[model samples]
Target: MNQEPTAQEPILRIDGLSKSFGPVRAVDNVSLDIQRNEFFALLGPSGCGKTTLLRMLAGFETPGSGRILLDGTDIAPLSPEKRPLNLMFQSYALFPHMTIRKNLSYGLEMERLAKTEINHRVDEIMAVTDLTPFAERKPEQLSGGQKQRVALARSLIKRPKVLLLDEPLGALDKKLRERMQLELKRLQHEVGITFIIVTHDQEEALVMADRMAILKDGRLLQCGAPEEIYEHPADRFVANFIGVMNFISGVVTPNGSFEADGLSVPMPGAAAGPATLAIRPESIAVSMNGGGIAGSLVDAAYHGLDRVLHVKIAACETPLQVRVPAHTSADLGIGSPIHLGIDPDRCRLFPD
Candidate 1:
């Protein structure tokens, strides 16, 4: 007997989804599955279709093509209110005139849920979100973070199958935004609801997402764990997008080996052709004693726990950045001779 694989199926699946606005294609043939209770992020630069994709999932925009399957059933034809989902906007769109408690209860009130049920859910969410004390305060009275919580509490009060957030913390200061990233991740686990967030901030996506999908030019690029994509990027674009990647032009030899800056790099996956070798700043070892690849220090910057040293090599035109602990660095000035220790095994090769 054929059985439905409900147990292992992803909570949401986007199959070949695409959307176009007149002459512009906002999203193109994108497909990815999001697991149940997963903290997933839709990461990309501005105008890269992440927000458009989120809107499509929330029923705000119609897809020009493809299927949006939620729990194995297509939700494309369903209207915003009919779908079991909620969209939290970047503006933290709380009703200014309504109190925090009233704002949280608005959705339930519209659904005509029992007064008792609405009160219980609103109070419960306020307590969970630490907004209990500010329950009577209006959105104008609360701080940015507290208002953000109220908006989040309102979105979560509905207990939808999935929660879609579009740059939920974009308005907060850097410190607050970073703090809220952890808070949002913790809240997602506490409620056990699948969260799909759209953002252009790579650090936010890397810090918050259990898994993430990268989109560019309306095309799906790569999707995987933060560390997985960072450690082994699928291509050059991805390598440069996630973090600070040091790229040096190189070539694959006829013997199926690669070399960069006159130093041989063993990239087993690279074929014989022109390629670029990529290595993280921390991967290269730098020293003033001069033992490895010799280069001149172009610039150095101290960032509390670590220091980044930029070196210019004779074989490479661009300055290569090397990261080392702050304590290990000496008082080396500009144009000072330095040595870089690069392990061939640590480098990644990408074809040009």
Candidate 2:
């Protein structure tokens, strides 16, 4: 089970934050509370203001109107260097010519710390990030993951109250990126620092963040734990963005039944009106034949562990995706007639 953040006093608070570039509003009246030692993510697609919000938090971008409070004190007026925070950019900005130790020590040295103290801090952070093995290597000598670790170590050696990561793993290959996702989570827990990462990848956010806020078109859409957001989306945008959802447009009848294109399903507690029902692919079951909704398999994608089938039904315009264990149906093929079993409890109803 994923651990939830406690109700401790929030370490960072964004209040009515908005940013604009001439006629374009990048971040519009966004607000959030991030708890101490929490691994929080700002998630959204491109042009959704996730990166802009992160920049504001990093003191790299000034908000047109708002207050950013760090530990109860507004830090909006502080410069990037003055804020007790560090931002690790997507491009591991380690000096190409500098050794890993030099890269890690450069920031501390810039502050004019004693040589012994800088060395001690660098050594400590390198150990924490497991970069000691490549301490003397240049940036070119290290792998993408190692370079990322070096960048993270450089940002973290200062013991900042908060660390901001802007798509820190986007440069790595698929396998390495996935490995770093878990590694980043483990590092966050080991250090007990508040980490705020901005990423458009839903799976990465879900895997690493303790809590996450979804943004869209410069507005805050939904904020919650991964399971909460995935299972209980607030609206259509969130349902569509977070994962694959099949929406069946229908109207709730007086008998608490939903009626669509020649199909009706019991939908208790739904107000009598037009609404959309959202169901995940995994929540639906498919079989060769049954007393359920009739559909024909349009396509089947054979993944290693599971098979995803696109079933075309007359009730809806688009095909509904059904995921099943790969071992269960070896003969399921395209154009095969099938029946769909939808779990009512797993369906989310929203007013149209």
Candidate 3:
């Protein structure tokens, strides 16, 4: 996580940004500030308008209203080429006939820079992205990872103020995708350029972003650090979207307590009506013998280092997913009596 410190002033700002296509509103009054040299993520599921927002930033799509400010200057009217921004597409989009060097040099060549300067920029970016060794290879001759590096190198050669990526690692396998998450972060740090990536993968944002904005149905839900949003979701949709959440339904009494599932917890400022207590799997304490809410282990799921146990409670309609260490779940089996203890402070209550 070590990298350059982000400046206090925002390098780019979206003010009341909105985009629409006929009857459909793609982005609705979204606003965010992205700091220089920081890795920011725009994350959401399909049709959530994350891609539309990114397109607005990249100048590919014009905003219906609001303004886009890059270093306090409005760039909404600027065309994509005129703006000092670059976008890397998901497909890599390399010319099959071009060598890795030419692919990286194409943008600079178009600018009609001196040959010496162009080669210098290409060489520096190649080394930064580790594409120097494959400089002479054509795009079709390279592996997925190498092609990706070449595409990235091509963009970085321009030394853009901001780089927009649309699911850059979507084509890679899971293992390679995971590895490239850190690699992208490293490149962002080394290049000292602000990177705004649009993706639907929750884990990708959590693993790569310094700060992230989550969207749904063209609405901006929350923006914060990965852990901040994960620990303190804005609402039920965000809690469920960001990660696995166990919601125990209940009603808030005037005394400020939510009672349900044979469990009662404090819910301050909550109105008297139906509510939900959301807790992550790791937050719930599990035990075989303790004065806690009792449930039966109905099913189990095995992950590498963790096991997800599905616990059934009579008061709850569906089974709760509880995460535990692999070792702790080894001796447990289906139909085993289990007890869950959740601290009142660890739960998030959303009043409906």
Candidate 4:
């Protein structure tokens, strides 16, 4: 999609945003517009300024220079508590002394809400997060997954305009983390509120976001839908960062194909130059007909779902990974000679 319908006003607009500490810049000239009820994510490595940008949105960090517009009004100078947003930290940060119900009601109580109002809101939040049974449970007695729900319930109880999450699932194990990803996405859709999440885990961002922004060294490298970012990455950095890729460096040929010594691969409509051709391992096809690029398999491993083959092509310095069906491993083996081919459309070209 070219862009979301922007004729409608954005719930949040950030323009020329920047933040610096001494000479070090954390966020640099970043601008973004998040639509109402959109599930947006900031994705990058640990030090790539995604967290800092999320903090700025939550009003926890002040921007050195920029304009933050919420519902068409500037909120740059507003205090964090006064802003119409809530931040869920990575640690959950639950008060150990309080019960789950108390934790959920803490924010409302601070607002000087009447006792009945607090009780009603707290019960409602408990139902939404499915923590109704564990309302009186202490943080120390809950499982990792349960604690995550408690944190989510606490932040969302107020029904803020935008909910910001900073690595909220980072504390869980692999299996639990994957499960929570689906839960979070479902909750976001059900709530119909703008959800902005900051995460270093690429899979988490891709699974949860309607669209994601990639940051690197305090710069916004690219922004697009999950499929767009994965299939047509903007550059080498994005391709390598989002997932595993087999990079082949070769000079562009006369017909817009890539030629690396004895190996020649077609690059449809690609410009002529010294370029890097990227192909995901899953996209490669192996043929027994002795066609395509000739390579000798150096290693093969069975991974339950698929068999991974590392092929070292002639005249190429690095090996290319080929994934074949798990059952096909009986036909292909280590040190076996094979030919690898990929559709021209599957190859991404980046000029050097």
Candidate 5:
């Protein structure tokens, strides 16, 4: 979980930003604030306008309306080169022919900085990114992770106020990508620069971002710390998008309870109306004999650390998924009688 940034002022603010292309609205009227030193992620599925929003911030794509403020000054009118920001693309776009050191110093060289100063900055960032040993290697000669480090080093060498990453670790293998997620977070903290990353991967955003904004079909759905977004999603879309969620359709009863199928659960403060109850797979406990709700195990998937069981019940149309420790229910097979235990307080109720 991330500490609340309520007391600190935002370093970057997006106010009513929007963009369109012919018949499609790529980015809607979205607004958000990113505090200094925060690892912020723009997360959503493909075609959700996350990249468009990031491009607008980088001055690569102009927004049709709204303002982008950096340090309290509107940066909407500023060109990409004029803004105190840098965008690292998914492809990295490093020169295949250039040495790692040369790639790191390319931006500073283009700025016409002194050779000595450029060398110093390059050396400093190389050490910071752990690319010092690979400085003499070319992109073609380096591993994927090594090349990524070179690209990151190049971006940081300029000392930009904010760094924008577009799927920064997309090209790496699964294991390496997972490793880089933590590295990216560490780098952000060590550099103390605002990092705004655009990614379609939910797990990536959840793992790396201190705070994240969820986008859906060009609209800003919700924004908050990773845990808040996952544990307390605002709506059906958010609940479904952030992680695996089980939704059970029900109606609020007159006596302040929710009734679904044959089961009734306490739901205080809920009005008498149709609602959807959302719960995570991990939150629902399974027992072989008796518990909260009676069900029959339909299938089970054996993951390395956990088992995902699909249990069929009369309460919902689809089988409910329950995740528990691996081999915990190894003795139980398909068609086995089971019971589900749900924590009412952990369940979220949304109007249907």
Candidate 6:
């Protein structure tokens, strides 16, 4: 008899999940699978329902329809306390009167774990989160980053199968937030638990998540690894939403390329009729000599890291943006003649 390979089932599966407040659909028929040990992000703008979906998964808000399964068991009907998961709220939700030790131990006490076990777990988590020095400090006494660490240690102490974080680092400043992103990623790897984070910050989601799903109007717009989403957006909305781009509307030529105004560039893929070509500003090449599209320099912005030149091509109505090295800022001037070119393969076409 041949032995069958062991299958690793998803840690959580949400099927046909929907929720509504009156006639407004907050979470509209959302379904997703969270694989074990995967760091996934639910990312979108404010009022896009990513947070609501995360809340429903944590059992804080019940789903009106469909089911949620954890380890292949129906958990939609289960209470938050009964589920094998923990949620770190956006505000950290640490008790103002409680010390860090008490905050970390509170969950264990609720479960009525032994004192020794709770102490051991607290110590372990404290070490990992670097919270040992502030163990006895209350939330009010701790710094914003320290407080965040406490909240994280509290959540991880329970050793839940899944960890859900709702804007957990929103309280910290820019420097601290960037630092904690790497720290949190390291912590997640150390613990080896599935993490589902909900955030409106695109950079945060892209930096931390192994894979992410973009939510808009309570619907999933795209789901894939960060590189896939950045390189191959599903549509114009996703393209504009995720990063900066310069759009040029053109008609697909018989030669499989597109032309608009004075610039004719080869399109990357097949699309017919009126179409819009999207190219990243950085993809554009600018030269002072006789090459590429001829245009007049309209404006330029110096961002320290790079310089962006705005050019008005004779054949196009919209000005094209070209990003160049900051060192070239002194060489180029307004009204200076320039030429721009892009690799044929870098252009992406979308039906208008």
State each model's C-alpha RMSD to the native.
Answer: 1.5, 3.4, 3.4, 2.6, 3.1, 2.2
Per-residue lDDT of 47-154 in model 4, one digit per residue for the tens? Answer: 899988988988888999999999888988999989988999889999999999999999999889999999999998899888999989899999989999999999
Candidate 4 worst ten-residue window by lDDT: 1-10
Candidate 5 residues lying further than 4 Å off, grouped into runs, are 1-7
| TM-score head-to-head 3 vs 4, winner | 3
How does each model score on TM-score?
A: 0.96, 0.95, 0.95, 0.94, 0.95, 0.93
Candidate 6, superposed: residue stretches over 4 Å from native: 1-8, 314-318
Model 3 residue 140 CA deviation in Å: 1.5
Q: Tell how far residue 196 is off in model 4, in angstroms.
A: 0.9
- Of 4 and 5, the candidate ahead on lDDT is 5
Residue 164 Cα positional deviation in candidate 6, in Å, after optimal superposition: 0.8
Provide the lDDT at 227 for model 5. Answer: 96
Steric overlap count per candidate: 0, 0, 0, 0, 0, 2
lDDT of 3 by residue, 1-352 (tens): 7654556779999999999999999999999999888899999999999988988888899999999999889999999888898999889899888888888889998899999999898888888888888989899998998888887888888999999998999999999999999999998998899999999999999999999999998989999999999999999999999989998888999988888858877777778888888999988889766678889999999998999999998668889989989888799979989998888888998887
Model 6 steric clash pairs: 261-315, 262-315
Global lDDT of each candidate:
0.91, 0.91, 0.90, 0.89, 0.91, 0.87
Which of the two, 3 or 6, has more lDDT?
3
Candidate 2's TM-score reads 0.95
lDDT of 2 by residue, 1-352 (tens): 4654445779999999999989999999999999999999999999999999999998999999999999989999999999999999989889998999999998898789999999989989988888989999999998888889999999999888999999999999999999999999999999989999999999899999999999999999999999999999999999999988999998998888888876677998789999998999999987565768888999989999999989998889999998999998788778988998887889998988
Q: Positional deviation of 126 in candidate 4, in angstroms? A: 1.1
Model 1 per-residue lDDT tens digits across residues 1-352:
5775776789999999999999999999999999999999999989999999999999999999999999989999999998899999899889998888899999999899999999999989988999899988889989988988888989999999999999998999999999999999999999999999999999999999999999998999999999998998889999999999888887898887776665776666568989988999999998566688889889999999999999898668889889999888857889988888888777788888
> Model 6 Cα displacement at 193 (Å)?
1.2
Error of 6 at 110 (Å): 1.4
Task: Please say which candidate is ahead in TM-score: 1 or 3.
Answer: 1
